[model samples]
Target chain A: MIEAEGIVHRYPGFSLSVSRLAVEPGEVLAVVGPSGAGKSTLLRLLGGLEAPQRGRVHRRGPAVYLDQTPYLLERSVLENAAFGLRLKGWPAQEARRRALGWLERVGLSGFADRPARALSGGERVRLALARALAVEPAALLLDEPTANLDPANVARIEALIRAERAAGRAVVLVTHNLFQARRLADRAVFLLEGRVVEAGPAPGFFQRPADPRTRAFLSGEMVW
Target chain B: MNEVLEITLRSLAVSSAATLIAAVFGLPLGLWLGARGAGRLARSLLYAGMGLPPVVVGLFFYFLFSRNGPLGGLGLLYTLPAVAVAESVLAFPLIAGFTMAGAASRAEGVRRLVKSLGGTETQAFLTLLAESRRVVVAALAAGFGAVISEVGAVTIVGGDIRHATRVLTTAVVLETRKGELERAAVLGLLLLGVTLVVSGLLVVFGEREAA
Candidate 1:
C-alpha cells in the first residue's frame, strides 16, 4: 500500500494540496483533471520523484513510475528493460533473461537488440512498460500513459494495466480520458485547480459526481 | 629530416600526455558539475576557463618552475614536463566544458527515471555518463585538438630545445625564423593533418549521435 497524507507542494505560481490519497493492492485509482490541474505533479510526489513541502508519504513495497513520454536509456532495448534488475543486483544473464521475457510479453522480442533510440513512439511506450513490469513492482504510478497514443496502442496499454491490477499490484493512473477511467479504474478522483473536488467508486463518480466541478468536468465542460 | 620525425613524435607524446592528465581530472569535475545541473556560476567559470590563453597558461607555469620563482628547486622549467603542464591547463577547460554540457543535457528525465527505478546515486551517475559517452568522446577530441596544435604555451615553457623539448609547433617557428621554409611547411602540414584527424573523428561521432 502507498498513502500520502496532508501533502502540500508549492511552485512559483501554484500549489497542490492533497489531504489524503491511498492506493491499496489490486486497486486501480484513476486521477482525472483538466490540463495544469497538477496530475503529473501529484504522480511525481507519489513516485518519490519529488517531495512535498508538508506531508507524509508512506509506501510498504517497491514501486516504479512512468512518465507520459517514457525516457529510454540510450542503449539496446534489452539493456534498458533490464536496467532495474541490474540495479537490484541481479546477475546480468538472469536479468537479461527476465527482461527478454518481459519484452516478449509486450511483443517486443524481435527488437531486443535494437537501440532504444530507434524505437518508434508506440514501441517506446511498450518498451517502457516492459521495463517497468520486468521488475514486478508492487506499485506503479503512470502519468498520462495513454495520452496521444493511437487507439490500438491505448487498448493494449489498458489491457496491460488490467493485467497488473489482476496480479495484485497497486496502479495509479492519471489521464484525461473519461471512457478510460470508466473502463479500467476501480476508483476515481477528480482534481480541480490542484484540489480533489470529488473521490468515489468509479461508476458512482462518473455517473453521479457529488461536486459541481466534477459534474462540469464530466459533462464535457472545462472546469478551469 | 630525422629531426622533424623526432620533433613530431615528441609533440605527439607531450600533447598526448597532457590530454591524458586533463581527462583524468577534468572528466570527473565535469561530471560532478553536470550531475548537479551546472548552475550559472559553474557554467560561467568553466567558459571563462575555456577562454584562457595558452600563452598565459604557459607563462604561469614558467613562473612556477623558473629557477628564480617559487619551487624552482624542482628544476622543471624549460622541460617537456613543464610544457605538458601548460598544455594540460589549456586543454582542461575544453574537455570539462563540453563534458558538462553533454552530461547535463536531458539529465533531469534520466535522473528521475533512474531514481524511481531504485538506482543509487553512484549507479545513476554512471548511467548518466554512459548516456553521454558520445558527447564525452567529442569533448576528448576537442581537448586533444586544443593541446596538440598549441604553439605559444609549448614554445614559452619548452624553450624549443633540440632533440629534447622541441615539438612540431616550436620546430615550425624555429624553421621559419631560420629561413627553412620547406621544413616549416612540412611541420605545418603535419600539424594540420593531426587537427583534421581529430576533427574528422568529431564529425563521425557527431553524425553517429545525430542518427
Candidate 2:
C-alpha cells in the first residue's frame, strides 16, 4: 500500500499540494496531467526519493521509482539488473541468477553480457523494468516509463505493469497518454497546474469528467 | 649507464608512490565534493591548489623537515621519502580536481538510481565512485604525470643526493649544471618516455573497460 496525506512540496516558483491520496494492493492509480503538473514530483514523493515539506508518505514494504530516462550503471546489462539485489546483500551468484530470470522474462536474455550503454532506447527501458521487478517491491512508481517507445515496446511494458498489478503490487503510473490511463488504470486523477481537478474510477473519470477543465484537457482544448 | 638506470628506477618509484598516496586521499575527497555538488568557493580553492607553484610546496616541506622545524626530530629533511611527500602535496590537487569534475558530471543520476533501488547512503556513494572509475584512472594518470616531471619540490626536499635521493628530473638538473648537456637531454627524454608510457597504458585500460 502507498498513501500520502497533506503533501506540500515547494520550489522557488511552484508548489504541489495534495490533501490525500492512497493506492491499495493490486491497484493501478494513474496520475494524468499536462507538462509541469507535478505528476513526477508526486511520484517521487511517494517513492521516497524526495520528502514532502509538509506531509507523510506511508509505504508498505519497498517501493521503486523508475525515472523517465532511466539511469543504467556503467556495467554489463546483467550487473545492472543485479544491482538492487546486490544492494540487499544477496550473494553475487544468487543475484546474477535472479537477474537472469528477470532478463528472460523481459525477453533480454541474449543481451545479458553486453555493456548497458550498448542497449537501444526501448531495450534500456526493458532492462530498467527487469531491474525494478527483480527486487519484488510492494509498490512501483513509474514516471513516463514509455514516453517515446514504439507500439510493440509499449504493449510489452503495459503487459508487465498488468502482471505486477495482478500479482498484488500497487502501481502509481504518471503518464501523459490518456489512452494508456484508460487502458490500465483502475482509478485515475486529472491534475492541472499542480492540483487534482477530478478523481474517480478510470472509466467514469474519462467518460464523464466532473470539471470543465478536465473536459477541456480531454478534448485537447487546454493548451499548456 | 648504471647510474642512469638507477636514477630512472628511483624516479619511477618515488613518483609512483607519491601518485598512489595522492590518489588514495584525493579520490575520496573528490567523490565527496562531487556528490555534494561543491560550491563556488570549494571549486575555486581546488583550482588554485591545482595551479599552486611546486617550489612553494617544496619550501613548505623543507621548512617542516628542516632542523629546529616542527618535524625536525625525525631527521627526514634530505630523504627520498621527503621528496615523495613533497611531490604528493604537489600532485594531490590535480588528481582531486579532475576527479571532482568527472564525478560531478555523472554522480547525480547514478546516486538517484542507486537510492531508488533501495540502497543505503553508503551504497549510493560507493556506486557513484564505481561508476566513475574511468575518471579516477584518468585522475591518477594526471597525478603521475605531474609528479614524474616535477623537479622543484624533489630538489628542495631530497637535496638531490646522488645514489640516494637522485631521480630523473633532479639528475637532469645536476647533469646540466655540470655541462653534460647530452646526459641531461637523455634523462629528459627518458622522463618524457615514462610519462608517455604510463599515460598510454591508462588510456588503453580505459578503452578496454569501455569495450
Candidate 3:
C-alpha cells in the first residue's frame, strides 16, 4: 500500500497539492486531470521520486514510476529489462532468464539481443513496461502509458496493468483518458487546478461527479 | 627506413602512454564531476582547460623539468618521459571535459531511471559511464589526436633528440628545417596514417555499440 497525506509539491511556475491519497494492494487508482493539473506531480510524490513540501507519503516498499516517454539504458534489450534485478544483486543468470521471460511476455523475445535504443515507439513502451514489471515492486506509478500509442498498443498496455493489479500490486495511474479510467481503475480521483475535486468509485465518479469542475472536465466543457 | 621505423615506434609509444595515463586520471574525475553536477563556473574552468594552448602547456612543463626548476632533480627534461608528461597534461582536459559533458547530457534521465530500478549511487554512476562510453571514447580519440600530432610541447620538453625523443611531429619539423622536404612529407604521411587508423577503430567500435 501507498499513502500520501497533505502532500504539497512546488515548482517554479506550478504547485500541486493532494490532501490525501491511498492505493491498496490489488487495487488500481487513477488520477485524471487536464494538462497542468499536476497529475504527474502527484504520482511522483506517491512514488517517492520527489519529496513533498508539507506532507508525508508512506509506502511498503519502493514504487516503480514509469514516465510517458520510455527511458532505456544504452544496452541490449535483455540487459535493460534485467537492470532492476541486477541492481538488487540478483544473480546474472537468473536475472537474464527472468528478463528473457518478460521479454517474451512483451513479445520482444526475438529482439532480446538488439540495442534498446533501436526499438520503435510502441516496442520501447512495451520494453519499459517489461522492465518495470520484472522488478515486482510494491507499487507501480504510471503517467500516461498509453499517450501517443496506437489503439492496439494501448489495449495491450491496459491488459498488462490489469495483470499487475491481479498480481496484488498497488497501481497509481495518471492519464487524460476517461475511457481508460473506466476500463482499468477501481477508483478515480478527479483533479482540477492542482486540487482534488472529486474522489469515488470509477463508475460513480465518471457517471455522477459531485464537483462542477469535475462535471465540466468530464463533459469536455472545460477549456483547459 | 629503420631510423624512420624507430621514430615511428617511439612516437606511438609516447602518445599512447600519454593517452592511457590521461584516461586513467581524467575519466573518473569527469564522471565524478558530471555525477555530482558541476556548476557553471566549474564547467567554464574545464572548458578553458580544454582550450588552453598546447605550446604554453609544453613550455610550462619545460621550465618545471629544467635543471634549476622545482622538479629538475629527477633529470627527466629533454627525455621521452618529459614529452609524455607534457602531452598528457595537454590531453587531460579534453578527455575530462568531453566525458563530463557526455555524462551530464544524460545524467538526469539515466540517474532517475537507475534510482527507480533500485540501483545504488555507485551502480548508477557505473551505468552512466557505460551508457556514455561512446562519448568517452570520442574524448580519448580527441585527446590522442591532440597529443600525437602536436609538435610544440613535445619539441620543447623532449628536445627533439635524434634516435631517442624524435616523434613524428618533431621529426617532421627537424627534416623540414634541414631542407629534407621528402623526408618531412613522409613523416607527415605516417602521422596522418596513425591518426586515421586509431580514429577508424574508434568509429567502428562506436558503430558496433550503437548497433
Candidate 4:
C-alpha cells in the first residue's frame, strides 16, 4: 500500500496539495489532469523524488520512481536495468540475471549488450519500465510513461502496467491522456489546479465527473 | 645513431613518467572540479593552469628543488627524477582542468536521479565519471602532449647533462646548436611522429564514438 496524507508542496505561482490519497495492493490509481495541473508533481511526491513541504508518504513495499524524463545511465543496457537492484544490496550476478529477465519481459532481450544511450526513444521507455519492475516493488509510480512514445510503444507500456497490476502489484500512474485513464485506471483522481476535485471509480468519474472543473477538463475547455 | 636512439628512448621514458604521475594526481582533482562547479578560486586556478607557460612551471620547480632552495637538501636537482617532477607539474592543470569542464556540462539531473535510485555515493561518482569518459581521455592526452613538447623547463632544471638528462626535446635543441643538424632533424621528426600518431588515434577514437 502507498499512503500520502496532507501533502502540500509549493512552487512558483503553483502548488501541489493532496489532502489524502491511498493505493491498495494490486489496484491501479491514475491521476489525470491537464498540463501544469501538478499531476506529475503528485507522482514525484509519492515516489520520493521530490519531498512534500508539509506531509509524509508511507510506502509499504519497495518503491521505484521513474521520472518524466528517463535517465538512462551511460552503461550497457543490462547494467542500467540492474542498477537499482545492485543498490539494494543484491549480488551483481543475481541482479544482472533478474534484470536480463525483465529486459526480455519488455521485449528488449536481444539488445542487452547495447549501450543505453544508443537506444531509441521507444526502446528507452521500455527499458525504463523493465528497470522499474525488476525490483518487484509492491507499488509502481510512472510519470508520463507514454507521452513521448509512438502508438506501438504506448500500447506496449500500457500492456506492461496492466500485467504488473494483474501480478498483484499496486500502481500509481500520472498521465494527461483520458483514453489511458478510461482503459487502465481502476480508480481515478481528477485534479484541477493542484487539488483533487474528484475521486472515485474510473467508470463513474469519466462518465460523470463531480466537479465542473473536471467536466471542463474532460471537454478540453480547461486546458492549462 | 645508437647514442641518439638511446637518448630518444630515455626522453620518451621521462615524458611518459611525467604523464603517469600527473594522471595520478590530476584525475581525482579533475573529477571533483567537474562534479562540483569550481568556486572563484578554483575557476581562476583552472584558467591559469590551462594557459600555464611550461617555462614558468619549470622555473618554479627549479628554484624550489635546487641547492639553497627549500628542497635543496634532498639533492634531487639536475636529476631525471627532478625533470619528471617539473614536467608533471606542468601537465597537472591541463589534465584536471579539461576534465572538470567535461564533467560539468552534463545535466545535474543525472546526479539527482542516481541518488534517488538509492545508489551509494561511490556509485554515483563512478557513474558521473563514466559519462565523462571521453573528456577525461582528452585531458590526459593534453597533459601528455604538453610535457613531451616542452623545452625551457626541462633544459633549465635538467641542466642538459649529456646522456644523463638529455630528453628528446632538449636534446634536439642542444644538438642543433652544436651543428649536429642531422641528429636534431631525426629527433625532431621522431617527436613529430609520436604527437601525430597519438593525436590521430584520439581523433579517430572520438569520431568513431561520436558516430
Residues A1-224 of candidate 4 have per-residue lDDT tens digits of: 88999999999999888899999888889898877888878887887776799999998877777777688877789988897788788999999999999999999999998998999998998898888888788888888788878999899999999999999999988887889988999999988789999999888888898889889988889846
Q: Once model 1 is optimally superposed onto the true structure by TM-score, how far is the C-alpha of residue B93 displaced, in angstroms?
A: 1.2
Poorly placed runs, candidate 3 (over 4 Å): B203-211
Q: Please write out the lDDT profile of model 4 over residues B163-209, one tens digit for every residue.
A: 78988898899889999999899999998877667667766775454
Better of 2 and 3 by DockQ: 2
Candidates in order: C-alpha RMSD to true structure: 2.4, 1.8, 1.9, 3.5
Better of 3 and 4 by TM-score: 3
**Ranking of models by DockQ:** 2, 3, 1, 4
**Least accurate 10 contiguous residues by lDDT in model 1 chain A:** A215-224
Ranking by lDDT: 2, 3, 1, 4
Q: Which ten residues in a row have the lowest lDDT in candidate 4 chain B?
A: B202-211
Error of 2 at A182 (Å): 1.9
Give the TM-score of each candidate: 0.94, 0.96, 0.95, 0.86
Model 3 Cα lDDT, one tens digit per residue, A1-224? 99889988888988888888899999999999898888888887777667799999999987898878868988899998998998899998999999999988888999999989999888898999899888989899999989888998888889889988998999999988888988999999988778888999888888999889899988989897
TM value for model 3:
0.95
Model 2, range A73-162, lDDT digits (tens) per residue?
Answer: 889999999999999999999999999999998989899999998898889999999999999999999998889999999999999999
lDDT of 1 by residue, B1-211 (tens): 6877787788778988898889898988888788888889989989999989988888888899999989589999989888888899888999999988988875777788788887877888887877877878888888888898888889889898988898888888989999999989999999988778767876687557531
Against the reference, the lDDT scores of all candidates come to: 0.87, 0.91, 0.88, 0.84
What 10-residue stretch in candidate 1 chain B is worst by lDDT? Answer: B202-211
lDDT of 4 at A23: 92
* Chain A only TM-scores, each candidate in turn: 0.97, 0.98, 0.97, 0.96
